[model samples]
Target: MECLLGLLKVKVVRGLNLAICDPLSHSSDPYVVIHLGQQKVKSSIKYKTINPEWNEELTLSITNMMLPVKIDVFDHDTFTKDDSMGDAEFCILDFVEVAKKDLNGLPDGTVMKTLHPDKDNCLAAESHIKWKDGKVTQDIFLKLRNTETGELVLHLEWVSIPGITH
Candidate 1:
């Protein structure tokens, strides 16, 4: 956790660093984005491989709203000759809430909605909120359709908070 000076009060970042490499193929670099409400916060992770893999750890600031933090990863396709070929994976990790003693289990889960593909345009797949054990923090996977190809693609897994929950 780190502290920063804000306008009025101090802002605390109690977030986890996520390292996502080439999930599907080792050739392309992974593109990552953090969605805070309707605004999309661009992360440092981009579509480029340094060593054997590409990695980036993003810090998500905790807020008071019951907002679902979404992480969208797209394959670096611009480098390739073909611009149309790429895979975009979307994931809503968890809600940002103050670290409280009573909030062991995540009261609300993420909901998926179908959308058109384009920078924060539309979500291809949708799901409803389902409460589960707090201790069980695993990647929630979802399948979405690529608007161009209309093929079902596997999106990124949403990681849940570990210590705060049961």
Candidate 2:
């Protein structure tokens, strides 16, 4: 008899969707979190799945400046203690700089220009950056919203690390 080895590799990027297969069929109540320095971060989309014999694909929204992202998946079964597993070391993605440009439409237009853009939206739009020879340069877009007024306030701009294109 011969032996077969399988390896799993996952890449965590901004404004991108990722999938993780359920390692066990017993239960699927996995959650992921990110860590930067001593800070712990949570995902924007949180859900539970009852699907068995399959994996879960999740779309991640660009969060605030959190680096050295650490992913952990936890499984809670009905009969056993919660099983914590799945950890991956994400590359150190940092917020290099930020800028802003005027919205592309006229002031009196009906479709209304970006009321306000924030750093997060910038990262989402420029998801595919240029990475060559371990160097990267790119811009992200963000639309800022006012919590009290419920209006678009400003536009956000951001750049990624040299090696992290887009």
Best by lDDT: 1
Per-residue alpha-carbon lDDT of candidate 1 for residues 1-166, written as tens digits (9 for 90 to 100): 4232111111112112222333464443444445654446543433434221223333444432344544454444545532222233333333211222233445554232223335552334343323234321222222222323212222222234444342
TM per prediction: 0.33, 0.32
lDDT of 2 by residue, 1-166 (tens): 3211111112222221223324453324645454544545543332344221222222222333334434544444557865543444332243222112223342332221222233433222333332322223222222112211111111112332233322
Using TM-score as the measure, the top candidate is 1
* Model 1 pairs in collision: 112-126, 112-127, 114-123, 115-122, 115-123, 116-122, 135-166
Candidate 1 ranges with C-alpha deviation above 4 Å: 1-27, 38-55, 77-99, 102-139, 142-166
> What lDDT score belongs to each candidate, Candidate 1 first?
0.33, 0.31
Q: Native-vs-model 2 lDDT?
A: 0.31
